[model samples]
Target: MARVVWHVPVTTSGPGSTTALRLFRLRDGRRCAVGFSSPAALAALLGPDQAHTELGEPALHALTTPLGVDVLVLDPRLVAPPVTAPATPAAPAPTALLQHR
Candidate 1:
């Protein structure tokens, strides 16, 4: 079965945050870009909290901000996928670890 499309809602407030909570979803393993692009339009999206940021990038999502990194990153809340979940009762970590060592 095809993997389910994961939808993420990103809300930012405080310095460099959006004035209102905005939602963005992942598409084809990449973030689907938002369309609100004018400098004034972008500014309106940010309340006093994010007023200090300079408006750049016309095609930016309303809820995203650079976190000292030039590239986008996966949200920290995303845990290792189900495939990486704890081993089943049939298989345990200690047995595997001892076998390899």
Candidate 2:
């Protein structure tokens, strides 16, 4: 029998460029780890630019358990579009001041 593996999202952390498992929060604010059954499933929910790695279900659980994360969401559907921050306004140029002798 073929074993099932999942695509887990990851983010770079610290100066050493270590990869960390990306966790999500539920509507109630509880933290949960997320994984996708396929690369397409992951991209559909998190977009094509998201970074990920492949792991089995047991491996995913082992990595998340220590972080107090017990829930593993697989192939989750989005109820709404993802939110993004508004762009920051450009800074104004400094003006030269004339000094009086």
Candidate 3:
């Protein structure tokens, strides 16, 4: 069976105050770590007195709809497009008369 990986963002308040939580889950009950960010601005995006919690599969499925978290699907063979080099003007061909001078 093909595995599907999902990137979920979670928010919690603690020592660092603000953080980007990354949750990865596969189709066959397998999971792995992806990545996260520690941007303070993320706090503003959250509402006041909002409760945050991380629950396992059981609790996660209990919810009828998505909560505060944003889910993103990730491709296993992720690769960034190659950056092309800037074009440089070719040097003008040297003229025979100019070369002789």
The candidate scoring highest on lDDT is 2
- Clash pairs, candidate 1, are none
lDDT of 2 by residue, 1-101 (tens): 79999999998875579998888888888999888999999998899988999999899999989989999988887766679775887678998999999
Please give the lDDT score for candidate 1. 0.36
Candidate 2, residue 100: the lDDT equals 100
The segments of candidate 2 whose C-alpha lies over 4 angstroms from its true place after superposition are 13-16, 81-101
Ten-residue region with minimum lDDT total, candidate 1: 67-76
Question: Poorest 10 consecutive residues of model 2 by lDDT?
Answer: 77-86
Per-residue lDDT tens digits of candidate 3, residues 27-80?
Answer: 554453332122222233333333334334334433412543333332233344
lDDT of each: 0.36, 0.89, 0.40
Per-model TM against the reference? 0.20, 0.72, 0.24
Clashing pairs in 2: none
Clashing pairs in 3: none
Using TM-score as the measure, the top candidate is 2
